[model samples]
Target: METKFDSTADAVAAALRELIVGGELGGGERLVERDLAERFEVSRIPLREAIQQLAREGLVEVFRNRGAVVRTLTAQDVEEIYGLRVLLEGDAIFRSVKRLDEETLARAELVHRLLGEAATTQKQGELNREFHALLYGACGNARQLASIRELRAQVERYERLQNTLLADTPSFQDEHVAILQACHERNARRARALTAAHLDSARRIVLEVVERLAA
Candidate 1:
């Protein structure tokens, strides 16, 4: 029996995103419209809309013969995504540090604590996004923040790979502590540099694993 959703395109997209990011739908796997429509209990219109949405987010690609396929990130794609992230997120962190408020920092601290206690990768990822969003919310540039979010979504699958494959990956908790401390001290330069380095570290690890997986 298929579960039915009172589904809009966004709802459908969210469901598909969860499956894709969770690795239930692996790279290059075809998304058959009729099957997905039946599974999601949605009309073909919204299902197609959802597919287009994921395509725009770079999680899916619609080819001529293949309607929609989960995208497989190349090493080059990972490099480009993280390269933009370092630049954009670094700037956001710099600006946000200068504007950091006590209440916001306290909230970030709580999220950081929760992030440290997260038992699963899924929980950790959710809390990690919340922590970063709290810190960067003071940047005063909504467009930049939106772009940062889009970039993050693009590489979430790769981030999962890093968490699963690399046993010796550095503690993001330690880095978050350092970043939060910089924000508390209102050290914009240090926060920016740390943000860049943190993203760069993940990029390197993910790129190495992606290459190894390809080989």
Candidate 2:
């Protein structure tokens, strides 16, 4: 049982990352180690380890004497994150199409259903991330999945802005539906192209939001 519970630090790190990526934790927020340790019901050791991990991931920055704060993205950071998303997610789609199996297809369909439901409930941002994750989940390459996951986390702030600007927009659903249909048809090229287009659309909205936010 001790061994089973050994990864306390890692678990805390993942939880914090998810919170930040899900926008439950916002940019420029300061993280107090002792406070977080108490809040998470863990010892300082694991809490500090977790925060260090987040620091490495660019989610948090450590100051010599000021503690840690959530990293804020500049305009350049926004552009770079979106650019990486296009490259990684686009490649994942191309690879995922060829490796697509019954299990993967089913997962995508389920995610699609959840996305639609999320839209109806006005939780578009969460559903959008789920949809993107499902699209790349079948790539069958651990490193690729990990890289995409990191990029997604880094861009979460921009995504929130995009979702706000496009509130109640069903465009994402339509885009996702087209991509899934292409994958179902075994059209790898079409899937790849559609994924690029999907990223392009998101890039446009996010860029505008970033500009406004920066201003």
Candidate 3:
């Protein structure tokens, strides 16, 4: 039975995003409108709208005859996405660290603490976003922040994949602490370097997962 939602399209999109990011939908799997509409207990219009939303997020690809399919990430895609992230996020963190306010740092610390206690991968991912946003939000560049958000969205599925498969890895948590310390010390150069290295580590891990999946 599907849960009732006031805003059907938004709810449906959120549910589908969870499914896709959780790997239940899998890459390259076609999204059948009739089946999905029936599953979500939503009419075709809202179901279509939900799929279109995913498409805009780069999570789904719309085709003429084939309809919507989950977007599969290639090694090249990982390289490009993480490359841009390194550039944009590195600059953002650098600027943010130099202008770091006490309030933002305190909020980030709170989020980091909550992140450590988060039991579920989904919860951790959400907190991770909040923590990074807090740290980078001090950059005072709206367009740069927006660009970083878009890039993050594009690679989020892979991040979830890494968390699910490599649950024992504490590297991300450790790196977050190091990055936060840099921010605390107001070391813009170190913060930027750590941020770039952290992203590179994630990119490499995701690339390995993609390769393993292909194999």
- Backbone clashes under 3 angstroms, per model: 0, 0, 0
Q: Give one digit per residue, the lDDT tens place, for model 1 in 1-215.
A: 99875459889999999998877888889999999999999999999989998899889999998689999889999989999999999999888887888998999999988876766677777887898998899899999998998788777776676465224224777888899889989999999998988887778777886788788
> Can you give the lDDT of residue 161 in candidate 2?
54
Which residue pairs show backbone clashes in model 3?
Answer: none
On a 0 to 100 scale, what is the lDDT of residue 49 in model 3?
A: 89
> Which structure is stronger by lDDT: 1 or 2?
1
Clashing pairs in 1: none
lDDT of 1 at 133: 92
Q: Any idea what lDDT model 2 has? A: 0.77
Per-candidate TM-scores read 0.91, 0.85, 0.85
Candidate 3 lands at a TM-score of 0.85
Error of 3 at 101 (Å): 2.4
Q: Give one digit per residue, the lDDT tens place, for model 2 in 1-215.
A: 34554499998998888778666777788887777888789998988888988887778999998898888877787778778878888888888886778777788788777766664322556666676777677787888888877776787566665355246356866888899999889898899888988877777776676688778
Tens-digit lDDT track of model 3 for 165-202: 23733778889899999999999999999999999888
Between 2 and 3, whose lDDT is larger?
3
The TM-score leader among the candidates is 1
Instruction: Name the regions of candidate 1 deviating beyond 4 angstroms.
Output: 1-7, 165-170
lDDT for 189 (candidate 1): 93
Model 2 residue 6 lDDT? 44
Q: Give the residue spans of candidate 2 off by over 4 A.
A: 1-6, 119-123, 161-168
